[model samples]
Target: MSTATDLAELTARVRAHLALRHPDSPIGDLKTLPGGHSGLTYSVTAGDARYVVKAVPPGQRPVGRNDVLRQARVLGALAGSAVPVPAVVASDDRQPAWFAMDFAAGEAVEPVLDAPEVPAGTARARMLEIASVLRRLHGTDIRTPGLGAPEPLDAAGELARWSRTLHAVPAELRPGGEELLTRLADALPSDGRQPVLLHGDFRLGNVLCAGERAVAVVDWEIWSVGDPRIDLGWFLLFTDHRNFPHLGRAVPGLPTEAELLDTYRDGRPPLPAMDWFRALGRMKMAAIMGHNLRRHREGKHHDPDQERLPPTIAAMIRTARDLLA
Candidate 1:
């Protein structure tokens, strides 16, 4: 990762690389885009061509947080599929991994999901569009050699992973995370699901909507071959008032949990014990918030946005426990 002083040097490197790739077209405007947590995004233009450069953050990144190569591979695999994903242009695996892709031409409408003023019909349409896109993504064949074979379901292993994450959090901030982990493990769903490609962090925030269509589903860092229900569970958790108090309100026209589930399950088998998955999702989020807050408190990372996460963590833990109840 390049230091602040070396940002221009990094840009220059990008310019030089693009120049070689397009010998007839010299690089033009280059600017860093914002709003991502794990990596940096830059809007680059060469002559008449425009693209997005996704790069790892300046410093070391935690596991599963930043995987530029994996993201590029997934995008490449989705080429010609129904899933709306940016086309990969180039990828570099050297230190401070980075890749370039076509700039998705739409606005991310996560914020719009909470706007009470938006018309009910418009809101409902947007929510359904999100579900539709997820359906396409999950429907993608995971057996493709490039995407690799689906990993066998390991409910116990999944529980253990979240448990480790919870234990790593500062006990003072999340005393109940461990207990919730135990309860979740004990009640882990035994009936296995057919493995599908899960957009692990699917939600409004990760989608860019154009009218009633999902232009693209960005942010593929945590994507994997897993139970498709996990994605549904995570999506519902994000919008559930019991979890994200600030952003979970039911907006006008926005599809209810039942509607979203219905849309997702249209042609698939019935989903089971969704509340359990929701509980696990909340637990996972709480642990992640705890970890992020821990990082901020230690002066390891300074992010003002994280200041509000402590309350979120508490809400998440309480929500997870209540779901168990």
Candidate 2:
């Protein structure tokens, strides 16, 4: 929904914010980056330095301050940790609603459902490496003030939250999601394990890779402290496509579901409701895609990339059903 004028206003505001943060640096050409349905991202160059700026839409700002502050806090904590996250520069929760960080220079590892030309062994190794990073993140203790919080959801809480999200979609767009949700709810695993800080959305698209190695992980809007299985389940839901040819290309030799679950367990107690969490992840994705499709159709926002949502939602529903079966 941004126009030339909106871009101008955003640029001016970004310049001001940068000046306040770094008075000695000179900002250069500012260009809007693509991808993301919720907010606008810009790649700005100041002198020889490059940074990425993410800002909320005007007139549609979040109910509270910019959520990027939370992202900054989390990434800052992972600074010396094994997790590969972008470097934080400045974050503000006030007007202009933006955060600036050192732009990670690498291609985002999306289209992970498609099989790559890389050797299957290499791909599997990389996937395992990615898994290792996620494991470390899930294992880390979030004890910092303002950063640590109780688990976002208990087993019952997750069911209620995802159920509400599914019901929020218009009845016509529900597809097969409702049935899948019902099955998931009734089949909830009772021996759920301890909760930890979850990445919330740990799919391949949010991760950046250089050749066979993951360089940085991006997109932290949904990050929170929750069941570690939630993160694992989300990853599996996105990558485990049995019918798509691209799936083979995306993650060659991708770990089996059992292997991922075992990796997550790693000597810890078993999660009783792991399947339910995975189903919840699929349902959440379906709802999000449905919502975005609705937004685009209603002319609230016109994102060309989101046009794929309808079919994807259908596919997600099918996957969720299979998980329950």
TM-score of each: 0.88, 0.83
Q: For residues 1-325, what per-residue lDDT tens digits would candidate 2 score against the true structure? A: 6677777877887788778766898977568787664576789987677899887766675532245566667788777678899888877676646778888886555444533454556555566667777888887777855565545675667767767877877767768877888788788777655677777778667777777788888888777776677788777664455422222234456677677666656776665666667777778787877787777778888877666566667777877788788
Name the 10 consecutive residues with the lowest summed lDDT in model 1: 111-120
Q: How does candidate 1 score on lDDT?
A: 0.76
Please list the Cα RMSD from the true structure of every candidate, rounded to 1 decimal place: 2.8, 3.4
lDDT of 1 at 308: 71
On a 0 to 1 TM-score scale, where does candidate 2 land against the true structure? Answer: 0.83
Give the Å error, residue 321, model 2: 3.5
Candidate 1 ranges with C-alpha deviation above 4 Å:
4-9, 57-63, 112-120, 149-153, 246-250
